[model samples]
Each structure stands twice: as C-alpha cells, then as structure tokens.
Target: MTIQRHVPATDAADRAMLEGWLDYHRQTLAQKCEGLTDEQLRTASVPPSDLSLMGLVRHMADVERGWYRRVLAGEDAEPLHYDEADPDGDFHLTGTETWQEAYTTWQAEMDVARRNAAGFGLDDLARGRHRSGERFTLRWIHTHMIEEYARHNGHADLLRERLDGATGD
Candidate 1:
C-alpha cells in the first residue's frame, strides 16, 4: 500500500508552469489506483462495459504513446494495445496481465510523453488531424492534454471510490 510522491517542481519557470498540471494529474491518477489488488483493478464495476482501473492505465498508456510518439513525432504509432477490433477496446483489460504490468506500461509511456513534451515552446506548432480536419498548435495540444487528464481523473476518482472505501483529496 506504499506509494511515492513526485518531487516538487524546480526553479525553472517554463517547466514549473507547463509541468505543474501534468505532474499533479499523474499523481492524482496514481493515487486513484493506490492499495488495490490486481483482481480489483481488473474488475469492471460498471456492468455492460469493461472499464476498469487496469483498463484506464492501459488506455492512458495508449493515449500518451499516441499523442507523444505518433502525432507529435510522426512515428506511425500503432493502435493501442487494448484496441482489439473495437475503438473502445482500450477501456478494457482482456488479458491475464497483472495490475503491476499495466502500471509499468503506463509509467513507460508517461516517461516518453514527458520527454517529448519538454522544451517545446507554447507557440510551437505541431499538426494533428481531427475529425473536422482542423489544424492544432502545441499550445492547443497542451491545453487538451490538461483537459483530458482532468476529465479522466474525475472518472478515476469515482471508480476508485467504488473499488474501496478509502477516498480523499
């Protein structure tokens, strides 16, 4: 049940600002999965859908990899590992892998994403194709990441609550 907290942001102004939210969001998600077993993490509390803590970890790994490796770096990232014939596949863990494995994958993806996100100017432009074919800038991507993490963190909070009675800030 032991979890390590991230170190505080340093004196670098840009990093302190840009990475502050990202760090907090990462910690929040980690906190959501704290003190849970593999079976509990893989259990889909909400029926009819396979969304679980392990699934969310896998999904986040896919997301970080997609955005940082594929979209940002143009590396032709394959679909998410859990995306098996269905677009929503990442929301479910369909295999026997342990929760620790999922968490490890998530950490790997986050490390890559953090490295990719570092040193980019807010005004830096990176192109992405959306459903509407709209062009986006790096600033937009950063904002979107923050928004996405926050939104998912809310869902994780509720999911964690359902998993265990332990809940708090």
Candidate 2:
C-alpha cells in the first residue's frame, strides 16, 4: 500500500550502504505482501508458527520506534503495535483492517527512525541503556536493524510463497 521499492547499491559510502540496505530490506517486506488480500496476508505461514506478513510489519514497526526514537533520538517511545498486556500482540491476528494499519504504522516508524538516525554520527552513543546497562552507538543500531529485517524477511519469503506461490527479492 504505497510502499516504495529500494534497491541497495552494490558500491557506496558507509552511511549510504547501511541506509540503502535497511531500506532495501524494508521494501522487500512490502513486496512479499504485495497484491495479497488482507486475509491472505494474515494467514499463518505454517501451523503453530503464528507468523504472518502483517505480523512482520507490525513487529518491525515496534522495533523501529524502540531503537531509533527511544534509544537513538532520546525521545519517549511508545510501541505502536504491542504492549505488556500482550507482548506478542504485534504478531496476533486482529482483523482484516490490520493490513493497512500495520503498513501505515511501519512506514511512520521508518520515517521517524530515519530522522532520528540522521541527527547522529555513526559513533555517537545513545541516551538509552541496553538491558545490560551499556550504551549503544548509532552504527550498532543500524547494523542490528538491518540484521533484524533480513531475518524477518526470510520468514516473509516463506510466508508469501505459502500464502500464494509468490516469491522474490
């Protein structure tokens, strides 16, 4: 739903490479959901897996806000798709309308994350502490986010293929 495709350059500067890859992974997630009905998107990839394309979208939105807004930008961040009442709520099927909402929220978080990252240098430390009470750098967050998307995108590929025989990069 209005997702822009991103193709990472094979050669670029450090920041460009990192940003391009993150954007590429983000677009890959959207491509996996393309042309499917909301119900199709909500369909579990495999029995007992509870993994759906919508879930990936929702989960990533939660991650983007948590890392970029709260950690990197030092801003108050509330999860857009989940909470303590149900920590796994992001992956829980809600309704047919959830497809649009997940995508919208994910896109919004991506924008915020971009803006947050833009204000910092790669080595700049975050205001927030890790669970171990260690500070994180912008570079670490960017690398982690890319890896997160990649792992989830792998799940997305399988889910999409199972959903409707669709698959691609």
Candidate 3:
C-alpha cells in the first residue's frame, strides 16, 4: 500500500504537535517498507542484529500495545509478537508470517493506541508504571513514542536503501 506522510504543523499545540510527529514517523516506517517483497521485508540489516523492516513493524505494534493498552489503559495486554522466553521474538521472524498479516496487526495496534489515548489528557498519569516502577504521564509517553519511532525509522531508511536504493526523510 502507498503511505503518505504529512509534515507536523510548526505552530500546533503541544499534544497535537506530538501526535502529528509521531504519526509522521510511523508513516515514514511504512513508506520505507512499501513496494518491497516479503523476502525484502524480512531481510536483516546485518548478521547478528536481526533488524528488518518487518521486525520493526512488529516491534512497533507491541510498543503501541505496551504503552497505550498495557500502561495507559491498564489493560493486561500481552505482547502480540514476542514473549518472555524470547524477549526479541518480534525482531526474529519465523518466515511464516505474511506481510499483510504483520501490517494489519500493526495497524490494528495503532488504532487501539489512539482510542486508548483519547480518554486521557496529556498531563494525565498512566494507570501503569515503567519497569523501573516510575509512572508515566501521557505527555511523556507521546514524546517517548515519537523518539522511538524516529530512531526506528532511521534504521528503516538504511534497510530500505540497502534493499532497493530508496532513500528519503
């Protein structure tokens, strides 16, 4: 599918700006994976790293679940693509998962995240805590998600370029 990334407005309010940039980064990752075959999406960036576009998509799906459903909404949401036994299972594809499946899952998680966040204001405290036992404000989660997506999107840029010579912001 084609992905269109809209630039965040320069003068938007804090929450709007954060959500805008977070979504922009999310679409950036999707755009990087566009037009690639399943093999290409599953191809690792380098040996021993296991970082692939498909893996990143799966990872972000879990990330959205973790921060939004598990933390913010206080739901007992389990990781969809990973488990305690294999903490990084999302990044280690088994070749049985189709691109459409992974994309659909990621999109679904994003939808849930949006719904979960909608009930709370930016300054509201989350119902869950970090592994370190620190509580999170919705503002912090939004900022952290933006940073997380931005970093992963950078990896996606390199992976896409290596796969097909495609590169962009």
Candidate lDDT (C-alpha), each: 0.73, 0.86, 0.91
Candidate 2 steric clashes:
0
Query: What is the number of backbone collisions in each predicted candidate, taken in the order shown?
Result: 0, 0, 0
Question: Per-residue alpha-carbon lDDT of model 2 for 1-169, expressed as tens digits?
Answer: 4667767777888899899998988888888888888888888868888988888888999999889988887777778767889899888876655677878888899998998899899889997866476789999999999999999999999998888888677
Winning candidate number (lDDT): 3
Per-residue C-alpha lDDT of model 1 across residues 1-169, encoded as one tens digit per residue = 5565464457657546556777777777888888888888888876776778788878888888877776665556676664456777777565686888888888988898778766466666554554355545556666677787788888787788877866776
Task: Residues 1-169, candidate 3: write the lDDT tens digits.
Answer: 5799999899999989999998999899999999999999999966668899999999999999999998888899888988889999999898887889999999999999999999999999999877678889999999999999999988998889888898888
lDDT of 1: 0.73
Among residues 3 or more apart in sequence or in different chains, the pairs in candidate 1 whose N, CA or C atoms overlap within 3 Å are none
Judge candidate 3 at residue 169 and give its lDDT: 83
Task: Write down the TM-score of every candidate.
Answer: 0.84, 0.93, 0.97
lDDT of 1 at 101: 84
Best by TM-score: 3
Query: Model 2 scores what on Cα lDDT?
Result: 0.86
Of candidates 2 and 1, the better by lDDT: 2
Error of 3 at 159 (Å): 0.7
